[model samples]
Target chain A: MAVYTEVTDEELSAFIAQYDLGAVLSCKGIAEGVENSNFLVVTERGPYILTLYEKRTRKEDLPFFLGLMEHLAEKGIACPLPVAGRDGVALRELSGRPAVIVTFLAGMWPRRISPQHCAQLGEALARLHLAVGDFRMERPNALALNGWKDLFAKSAERADEVAVGLRTTLADELAALEANWPADLPAGVIHADLFPDNVFFRGDSLSGLIDFYFACNDFLAYDIAICINAWCFEIDGSFNATKARLLLANYRKVRPLSRAELDALPWLCRGSAVRFLLTRLYDWLNHPPGAFVRPKDPLEYLRKLRFHQSVRGLGDYFLDDSATGEA
Target chain B: MAVYTEVTDEELSAFIAQYDLGAVLSCKGIAEGVENSNFLVVTERGPYILTLYEKRTRKEDLPFFLGLMEHLAEKGIACPLPVAGRDGVALRELSGRPAVIVTFLAGMWPRRISPQHCAQLGEALARLHLAVGDFRMERPNALALNGWKDLFAKSAERADEVAVGLRTTLADELAALEANWPADLPAGVIHADLFPDNVFFRGDSLSGLIDFYFACNDFLAYDIAICINAWCFEIDGSFNATKARLLLANYRKVRPLSRAELDALPWLCRGSAVRFLLTRLYDWLNHPPGAFVRPKDPLEYLRKLRFHQSVRGLGDYFLDDSATGEA
Candidate 1:
């Protein structure tokens, strides 16, 4: 639902001529990816996605995102490859915003998260972490533990307005997470926001991963923790153990978690939940009066945060090797 | 910017199974056409547009709209042909909304209107009118002369809130238009809203016309009048006579306008302007708070209405048969 900048035909034509991708047939603003203006651009060469980086995406961090995609694609990971122009540059300017055209991947994001979908996602996530191992660039996770206190500070005053006891609960969770947040774990370029929408599936099979705007160097298991929070929750806010087991088991098969990483799963989940809750809480509080995008319900994440807080151990989240099997 | 209904994988897969088209590879909700929730759905078979009719479009009128597109496409007109399912039904339900899949046309709508573009548009439009002449379906234009007064009544109170004398001016214009509205003009299925965005172009050539939701049975020349208001106006709120002359002349080459039709052009243009002005005015005044779709400025059409009111005769609108060439 984001096509913030309108690219004129003349501007687009001039922009397209810089690349060898044939004459422009059509460029349709597509309702995909929330962070940028995405156009499903079709030329004689075929379909490509034209993404104009919006305000949320930093101009400086684009190279890291683009480079990561190019690197992963070269490593045989199914992802969008940045199409470089004749000047051998993948990134350029269009409509006064940084824009890039990437090869269109044919798949839909699975709307209903199934156990198999989570299993496939776990493999893809693990592969992504391993594939970007040799990539040179590094971007710090902006929504990680280090940034949470500042984010919490911004939304602390109005936090309770979203849910009763939300402010106090968030404060307690943040203090606990900060004290016990795991460090010195296997870190790499993690898709910080590997929500179901960001992971595309061709039927039940994982086709590709997208939306690299949130990709950053962080604890790879923390990425899994984010996924656990996002994917394992049912509509009723209950945790699905089978989905969690599949996600974790398949992920471990690809990239075995360290003992420290395994131990930190529940806390990481809590921290990840709080991270999203704080950001969503901030957005829910700060959105303009007539803004088109409805702020995602912060209470949903509050419920998830509460669930993670109640988890007795990693076993509750289906960490296979853990001593405790259930809460 | 309108994907009001979210179609889940289970729902979409079940829906796609009803059709003979290949398995659904991808379905991205496209940021085209404002009225409906449109998705650029791609499958193993190729690309198609999946339109879920939203609130604005009446469900009962879908048959006429779908039938018109099917009829026009069969007549060798370049437009999206509604793809019927195996049961030979084009219209069906998806995500609790009436939906249809149509063949995807592969060209972009011209962002900047050129004289050549207008010329091409005139010919295509004339051809469209002639092609749909024998089509059995008959849908009365909902925004015709009769509808204008009702629309005006809704917005009349706050009309002047937008402009100084908009209310009084609109009332007088409506009365004059209603009194002088033409009868017995060559009538057929007219694309009531043939705005530039509805017409697609590859370079200077017209590739296709789309969004037949607004197509209806109306005075044939009145469609041309709508076009004159739409394509022949410059961005600075002035009439481009050269563009008008090209459009009218090219249109006549395909479907000749009768003497009565030519004489009635000014009044038709005025009526068309009022029709749009009233609708835009209604939308402008009645727009709900925090509504996503911004109501188009009614002042733009008011300016066009004023221009049409000042028209002396067919000469002002560049009716080619008139002796006053190059005005």
Candidate 2:
């Protein structure tokens, strides 16, 4: 929950004047998105989300994020369309920060993830991969395999403060992932952080995907691995193969995975786990005392990493028969 | 900025089932109102504010706050009307706390207060006083004179921690206020916490008043005193008598202030200062480490109290000659 920047009334009016979105009716700071200040701005025209990019999001990377959303949206993907000003410039400035307004999507993110939600998410994820096939913009995933060691270095010294043996465990995992990371796979733009909170649903159907701040060019199969870790895990740390089967089966229906991509799933999942674990560990160790956002538990991803380390093959994730049949 | 309660989608849907508001389209936790979990709930019907009362707000007081808003709205005062469910009940349970949905008001609180904003606030405040004259429900101001000593006792030991001699200063001021507080002045339902954030404006006009949880029966002049301290102070701890003059002058145009009420202004302002000072001091000293909502600066009110201490009479706040003319 964050609203790091407070937009003054004068600043807001001047900012809104750039757009065709009528007189401002109300602009409220919304408790969403941890990295940026978000306002649910209502105007004479309609509701839109005005986001002021905070320091965490590099200014240079905003064009790729906004352009990716625009690109995917044009390809018939369900996502927030960046609303440009009268001059047709979507990216602008507000309160001394890079700002943009996007059309408000109507749906609530599923708090209790159901198998149906996983099914819908799988199809949508595959569609998103297919949609970005023709997009020209490219941004390498900054938190991918290449960045894990650097991230771990910052938190390694105090890792054991969170749990005993955590430092050694992370070091070993980082070495293993760095040595075995896959290079040959179907690559495209992937929603690197497609947690349940970022995917919204209206009833049983997927409504939209949001928060493209982490979108980047990476192995598309790795995106599925991220989803399997995010969606298939229960609160008690047990894996639900049924949800994984549905997610993978539905995803393959839209875009068939190559044989090599299927074989690399375990390693991708482990890499995905390390990516989150390292970031979460850094945040856990470094978050300011009395910070509004409670840093996510890094150990949860550690548990996921352990599960991935134990996996013998694809059979450990989903039944081969279920993959052939209807999910 | 707060969203203490995390309402699950299942719980939210079940809660909305009790209402005729169309299917839940979206519900985003908003960073507003420190005392409750507020969501900008948009449905098929329209937008509304779904507030889940936090622990700071007593369960028994829900009826008074909701009822007062309903009463005030019916009396033609622009405020959020508590929306009743299908069963004609506005108050219900959500996420195991008292909750109510109120019609959304469309306006933003002035981030930079101007004299015109003060004038609008003055007229709106007077109208609110007149509108609530017939309100049947009565709640004594819990943070008023009778409650200050007990509040001070909670923080007296550490008062000086905030500033040198603050403990003695508060103790002596409490005693003096207890001795001088007026007994026979105009009394009615007062929005005791009519801070700038609680009042909404569209351009230069007052659109509505909100956050009625602090509404209670008190001397009407004391409400003006609260506004004087809130809307008439500059950010640098300097008092703007021009803003005060515009506020009080416009307020009298709607409901004339009695000579006695005018005479009691200084003491009322001082008492109002103490009321906030003790509460803020208590919050400052008692808030848990790493709490999300930052405790407001108690010293700001200390400065305001000091300013009120130096004022000799109404002349110090405003010119009496301007009271009869246009603000």
Whole-model alpha-carbon lDDT for candidate 1: 0.86
Interface RMSD of each: 1.6, 1.2
What TM-score would each prediction reach against the true structure?
A: 0.94, 0.98
Candidate 1 lDDT at A224 equals 93
Best by TM-score: 2
Q: Give the per-residue Cα lDDT of candidate 2 at A274.
A: 86
Q: What is the C-alpha DockQ of each candidate? A: 0.68, 0.80
Per-residue lDDT tens digits of candidate 1, residues A207-252? 9998888898889889999999999999899999899888887887
Provide the fnat value for model 2, as a fraction from 0 to 1.
0.85
lDDT of each: 0.86, 0.90
Tens-digit per-residue lDDT, A121-215, candidate 2: 99999999999999999999889866888888888899999989999998988888878888788899999999998999887789999999999
> Share of real interface contacts recovered by each model?
0.75, 0.85
- Over B1-327, each residue of candidate 1 has an lDDT whose tens digit, in order, gives 768779987788889999998899888888766788998887778778899999999988999999888899889999999998999998999999998999989787888898999889888988998898789988888888768877877888888899999989988888897788887899999988899889888766799999888888889999999999999999899999989888888888788887888888899999989888888888878878767666788889989999989989876665566522221
Which candidate has the top score in DockQ? Answer: 2
